[model samples]
Target: MTATIPLGSRISGERLAVLLGEWRRRGSRHGSTDLAAAVEMYVLDGQLPIGTRLPAERELAAALGVSRTLIGAALDRLREDGIVASRQGAGSWIAGTGARRRDLEIPVTDGIFDLAKAAPSALPGLTAAADAARHDLAAYVTGNGYVTGGLPSLRSRIAERYTARGLPTTEEQVMITGGAYSAFVLCLRMLAGPGDRVLVEQPTYPNALDALRAAHALPVPVALDPGEGWDLAGVEAALRQASPRFAYLMADFQNPTGHRLDAEQRERLGGLLARTRTPVVIDESLVELDYDSDPLDGPPPLASFAGELSLTLGSASKSHWGGLRLGWIRASADLLDRLLSSRFAVDLGAPVFEQLVLAAMLEPAGYAALAQRRQDFRGRRDALAAALGHYCPDWTFTMPSGGLSLWCRLPKPMSTRLAVSAANHGVQLAPGSRFGVHGGMERWLRVPFALPSEHLSEAVRRLSLAVASVRSCAGVPAVNVPVA
Candidate 1:
């Protein structure tokens, strides 16, 4: 008989109930579909990992204030979809590794707007850059193409950009990777291990949290407010108490919430981390996407304030193009050497052609592309905000200074339910719990404005429909319903 490896941990009925906040039947129907859809969304969003043992049907029903028959019906739906598996005597567990296969498929169909991903479309001049790169690639075709630490010329360009941005860097301090995700994983693998705690903001990039989990690092979250920015006191408390192996933060144009740490907060955070000698990884993927008139007004790189323990990460995926798949890490020479030693386990190096294309994008012509993106994004942001105000007035959100998405707080804690309902209305959303470390921010949602203005307006209209369905289910009155 083969021994089954134990799943990470079992979530209690109480915790699961908190995660399934207000998952009532929508669309004026009392059925198991809503419950089933909510669970599917939770699993798909990484809130519920595969192989997790679910609570007993009776226990779950009691916790959710629903009947056991309803819970059974919901589990039946999950089982049919391969989202959950049941045993004769043992119990139920989240099945088939990570998200339903259907949800992962991004279909290129019209009338369906996917607001789940925050990335924008490819920038202008990308084709021209790729064409130029092919010509440049001919020069290196003869030599061995696999350079683990990345191409020297590309690294030099990346290092120069970092130095110009207030942090003195050199080619030796930079290591190129596939993208920002790769850079983060490499850093985490080098710094943390199983059972080690990694400090993070309360709400952060979902993929980063997934990366930390993959590295087996226990994430300790410090509260960060969308309106007020980082809670330095909470961060200090976590650092002093948790003694985390490292702290991963998005200092500029933070994802989902789109809050940037101020200069003073940066200094204070750096000083505290330096005092503790804790290594910090600053994700600057969205740094260059600032919508401000005076780009110089943004906070300086966090590495400028921190000591040797700090490392900065940047990527061309956001500013230039996601298809390019080029990102770099800026660290001291010693740390760079350590990361390089382990880099081979993941990838040989970033593609030579992509590196060349990114290098060209860093030149003067690329600045024009970036400026055009800024203007386009600013207009889209305004359109999204207006649409949200017109369609869902009860919802509240702060205007993001920069970054791609709006972290919105729904009138009630129905983000997960709303996401499930929204999918039925031909719109996809990233619920708030996706960004949270645990599963408690059921009142929030991340609405990306990276799509076209018409799509943004249509998404809001669909969301209003979802909200109405929820209100109808809960017997609440809707005062305003915008005409589509």
Candidate 2:
């Protein structure tokens, strides 16, 4: 499969120059080191993918003006580092192991506790709704089995929720897809073409990066300020400069930082977007997950101020169950239709039974039954924070006012390495750069507090041990250790 790099990918021009310069400064005593650096340069430049066959040792040596021995040694080093592999007659191939995507599963091995995902346990009423939907599914599946815009009832429920939130949306303005991610792609296809810029926040959602890349829209990530919570001014600056086709901003209970844009900032951003005629894709996936603050007194949704240029996405996966695989989008009637038409190329909308189940769960009593999950998450958040304070106090983090994860800024830029180390100690952590734009953001870690309280407490303890191990390995004195 051919992988196309975004037009403005960091793998271009100046960054390439910097990488070559750095390698040049590291004088190769053996020429093999230089050849190893060249292979890395090719990978960094997007010229190689997993399993790409490299030129034969003699061929590469002749091309690079190096000896066959140097090429052989370089290939050996690359193999040892797991960056490449070789076969008897096949020469060497690039191994795309920078990171591997693993299926989401419950952790049960090596006494490990997974704090990697931020999702609540399925609440009480889902099964009842599911059972009710099974009858609906049996009847619904008998008809023409293609679903393009999802079931109408679920779309209506989604639109009603947006209208109730002050977005003035109509059911006709809604379309359903696989999940929030599918909704995002549909929006991208409708609003952006290849090479068109799309705005995202720095240190934002990792999967969104993958989505944007797959959509072929260049992601222009504006920085999010940890001090101010959300970056309203940065949004305005990016809008003025990039003139992106669409901007993906998390206006409520943002994922990693748990920062919600206050009313004033929301209005300001909404107005800025409106004036610039830029479509703002507001992802409110975590809206049902406010913890310390009550949204009853908060300002209206950004869509209220964005008018026709706003697109809203919501999912049952984060708020309900990932297994549900249901998500919806609210946008202008014209835009909604365009997205729906473009979506047929992706997949037949979400499963009919899942839609019925989600719609049933959106009813008043069903949602109330799910509210208990927020309280449960709060307990785990508190437990994890308290454990971290008592154990790994040196690692500074802001207790998120709401949302599933805490964004912790480590004292050093070793988060990826730290995650590998943490896994060795029976815990998994997402490296901060996973949320970063291009190849930035290394001095951070995102820990989810959405697990059971006991599990979260134990995860924090293991995390503390991991930090100690990393610090000992680095020969650094731990500072700012918090006391309970």
lDDT of 2 by residue, 328-378 (tens): 888888887777667768776777778888989989877677567777778
Candidate achieving the largest lDDT: 1
**In model 1, which regions exceed 4 Å deviation?**
1-110, 294-297, 472-484
Candidate 2: misplaced stretches above 4 Å?
A: 1-111, 293-297, 472-484
Q: What TM-score does candidate 2 reach? A: 0.75
lDDT of 1 by residue, 193-283 (tens): 9989888876788888888888778887665655787878667766877788999999887887788888888999899899999999999
Candidate 1 TM-score, true structure as reference: 0.76
Best by TM-score: 1
Q: Give TM per candidate.
A: 0.76, 0.75
Position 137, candidate 1: lDDT: 94
